[model samples]
Target: MENKSEEKGITRRGFFQRILVGFGLIISAGATGAIASQLLKSLMPSGWFGEPYVYRKVYAAPITEINQVGASIIFEDKANNRKAILINNGGNIQAFSLVCTHLGCQVFWEKERGKFLCPCHTAVFAADGSVESGPPEKSLDQYPVEIKDGLVYISFREPTWQPEQYFRGEGL
Candidate 1:
């Protein structure tokens, strides 16, 4: 057989076709990466609210009346430690960390705004601890609160940036 190379020399057409294939591959890979990134972001937990800690006491004011207008109440935990606000907005009773998720700034209830407000950056949160506006990319970590025997209970896991197995109910 004569040198096959003579007939099979890479032509401009072949070269252009190969370039197109490579470009297509690159674009496909980039799209896949973007999709994966979005999926991971959606799957990852933004933060952790610690375990439930219940407080049993007869409040000077009803839980409904106190938190109805968005007031932060400091109540003693089972361990008698001073903790953040325990809010009861109408039918929803949610306990959120007063500390801002962004920079540890104290967040407070603004009845006028109908949400929690962070003065440092004007971050606002709905009654359910979801970020309404501002720089916060994640919602507030929510603790499981239950009402038992006319008392309020708050449950939360410690705050964490990196996800841990314990937080995912792996060993929990």
Candidate 2:
């Protein structure tokens, strides 16, 4: 008696091998599709994403200007359009960016609680700009402080925003 598989020239082993080849092709096709999608996304234009700040050492204010301790004085860099807080904790001066890491809301220095509090999401940060407890995964950005010749110097970064310009007759 002649078996049907042998008569058709497709043995059981060949059938299994064909199934495995089909499965491998399907898997490879899916992987190729995922890679192609990621490449397309990367080529898209980035909208509303601003450039990183060019960090540098700049004078914030005079040491004598921040008279009170434990409290913070908000100062703005008109040239760079950046805002930061100057702290005088009993003659230990420190500066931190007002921008919260979680969101863009300004973080406040809670004198009584002795920490920075973000009123928007109830995020808390320590006096040293470390994250205490909050939804924010990262700590607040701190500025390096130095006092020279009765002057307060803070080394911080400031972003340089550029306007969108139409190029190749597009982005109109």
Candidate 3:
């Protein structure tokens, strides 16, 4: 009888120890999660950082030789998944973003219509980057092109919302 009583006590103690260990593990895991969440929140940038400004050499072709009047040659940014167009309007070289401002669809130049056409919807932009038809209320984003040493250069930055007649706005 004495041996049986001692055995029961030992089992009860072991059971209690296992329960405590499980509860401790649960609490530790919860704490780890809370700490990780706090750390991630702290590391995130406050508000939106200004769009990254970048300058890239687009093509080596001569500006005067390429006579793509209504057609545009597309250049892709693999890092941000954006496309730009280099248009040769007569002898002048201009670059416009292929991304439609309304719904983010890629626009293609239509030679017959002499405009930039979006296939997803019938959005059209005029020869000088103005949105003439469709849902796009703003003009096509333009990049300043500089030609030097027979190489074409284009400057691009992250899309920013600018107020009317304002170079630097509160949103940017």
TM-score of each: 0.47, 0.57, 0.56
The sequence of per-residue lDDT tens digits that candidate 1 reaches over residues 72-113 is: 565544443335567656657667667788887878777666
lDDT of 2 by residue, 39-106 (tens): 87676444235566666777778767886777567778664566788887776788888788998788
Backbone clash pairs for candidate 1 read 49-156, 49-157, 50-156, 50-157, 51-155, 51-156, 51-157, 52-155, 53-154
Residue 80, model 2, lDDT = 51
Query: Evaluated with lDDT, which candidate comes out highest?
Result: 2
Which pairs of residues collide in candidate 2? none
Q: Which residue pairs collide, candidate 3? A: none
Q: Give the whole-model CA lDDT for all candidates, comma-separated.
A: 0.66, 0.78, 0.72
Model 1: how far residue 12 lies from native, Å: 59
TM-score of 2: 0.57
Looking at candidate 1, what is the lDDT of residue 82?
30
Stretches of candidate 1 exceeding 4 Å from the true structure: 1-82, 156-172
lDDT of 2 at 152: 78
